[model samples]
Target chain A: MTLPAEYLATPRLPLDEDGGPVFSAPWEARIFAMTVKAHEAGVFTWGEWAEALGAELAKDGDGSGETESYYDRWLAAFETLLTAKNVAAAGQLADLRKAWDKAAKATPHGKPIVLENA
Target chain B: MSAHDHDHPHDHDHSELSEIELRVRALETLLTEKGYIDPPALDELIETYETKIGPRNGALVVAKAWTDPDYRERLMKDATAAIAELGFTGRQGEHMVAVENTDDIHNMVVCTLCSCYPWTVLGLPPVWYKSAPYRSRAVRDPRGVLAEFKVELPDDTEIRVWDSTAEIRYLVIPKRPAGTDGWSEERLADLVTRNSMIGTGLALDPSSLEDAA
Candidate 1:
């Protein structure tokens, strides 16, 4: 499938390659799809996402200039936009983060990590 | 693009979870609970990237390239069209470049700006690829990173590092092993590992396959 052509405009980031989206983990794909879905739903404009994501990318100002947790930065930008758009509350996200951490700790390995109360 | 320093989820053990795994789960739960994301759709998406589209596709391409000289030339001349010829195209791999590993030079891929990997062919970028250490160091010290991966090239072998981005993706066509002279594409495909295609490791040797078989 052809990717959205608008994504081609992102100058610095587009030194990209072809084929469908790939993620190292399920969550990476989830978050990536979510962002695209949200944009499609008009939750926020692409410009809005770029600005928000740009700010997050620019935060690591150490001039040594490195890429770290690319998806983590993406997640942060998504969170920022979601909250700014009031789609989800910041405190709610925080609470869920803690809850998952607790749930994950309680669960054994190789088992599907689920939040019973979530 | 390659394996991580720490153990990630594999077929054998899913017990040891990373912090990112936990955080991702948390985020998913929160988003799902808030009705921001549809659980069914997310599942489909994950399943697609996880199993439906991954390194296996690239393996097919590599295997075919290994067995067919004409296909290899086409792959080198135009990876996108060549890859598409085998029916692997879409999202993370709209623009594809295949770099061949030769006796004189080895090619490695890293996205210093972000984990810009050829997801369609590679499955997912490994956790280590996205890690800050690998991103920064892969460029500064390719030989050191190769050493850590147990891939020691001779001093005369030049290493060409390809930096990926959102627009283009790269696949490393590892040199075929010696003993597989008349191997079929199917058998050759098994020797093409994700790591081998990323230039972090070499293709499995025939002797190793014999031992395993």
Candidate 2:
């Protein structure tokens, strides 16, 4: 459950004088910037994330917070943020979940498969 | 009434469960009863993927990139389109992007939330890539994670970690390996490994394979 060091530390990218992470390749800086912006926008408070993450970690029966789980906690936080912000109408998220479930069930590869009729 | 309990023979509580949960439970039970869901079989399948399919698919993509400049450029800019150009686009690869390695920069990819991998392009994700251990660690200590995979970058090289979200999937475009001069695309493709495409390992050279042989 030990986390990798790179995940824990913030990366320093080559930047111009204004100090923005430079993007030499496609979509690299955009994704990084979005992550940073999402954090700053009060979409999900870091404290809430830490608490939820700590709870999940505790479920592993490991007291140490050394390990960090992938996107589950973030998804949960995003869901909460969406709910709080009223971004979608009531039950939209639930509908999407149901659709995803149906798609997973219908496809052998656990993806949404489209079958064309002859 | 409690002593007899005849009227309560079938529990009504089962009807209260969610449809998805009920369906899942029923499917699991049916599969188990049919003897089609053996734990050993599942383990074997997992092992096969971990040992074979993942790496093979990765190698093919890397080799193609190494030998074909146009393909490599397309992959770097619009991965899904580029992969479709090669007639290998569907399923998990519907939305894909490629991250390229350069002289001063290195790239690594991870699914920070769930194991949302581009399986069509890479066949299957390795056990480490899908494991909680790797997912949690890769984001925080990419260099350390790469080290575990035996990929050590120079100190001067900047590392860029790509987090694959629910919408978009990512593939790592490893820098073309040395000693592959005048090799065919097919030969180059043979040197591409799944780990290389995932940015955990480097692509092999045809000369290296020749040396080993």
- Considering every candidate listed, which one attains the maximal lDDT? 1
DockQ of candidate 1 compared with the true complex: 0.14
In the range A18-98, model 2's lDDT, one tens digit per residue, is: 332333211122223323334444544555545544444445554432211223333344444445555434665565445
Candidate 2 Cα errors over 4 Å, as ranges: A1-118, B1-41, B49-58, B112-115
Model 1 regions more than 4 Å off: A1-118, B1-55, B113-115
TM-score of each: 0.54, 0.52
C-alpha lDDT (0 to 100) for residue A8 of candidate 1: 44
Per-residue C-alpha lDDT of model 1 across residues B17-108, encoded as one tens digit per residue: 35665556666676666666787676555554554234478888999998898999888888899999987775334577888888998999
Q: After TM-score superposition, what is the CA distance of residue B130 in candidate 1 from its true location, in Å?
A: 0.7
Q: What i-RMS does every model get?
A: 8.5, 18.2
For model 1 chain B, the run of ten residues with the poorest summed lDDT = B1-10
Model 1 docking tier (incorrect/acceptable/medium/high): incorrect
Fnat, 2 decimals, each candidate: 0.30, 0.00
Tens-digit lDDT track of model 2 for B58-136: 4566667777787777666666777777666553334677777888878888873323667667754555665667877
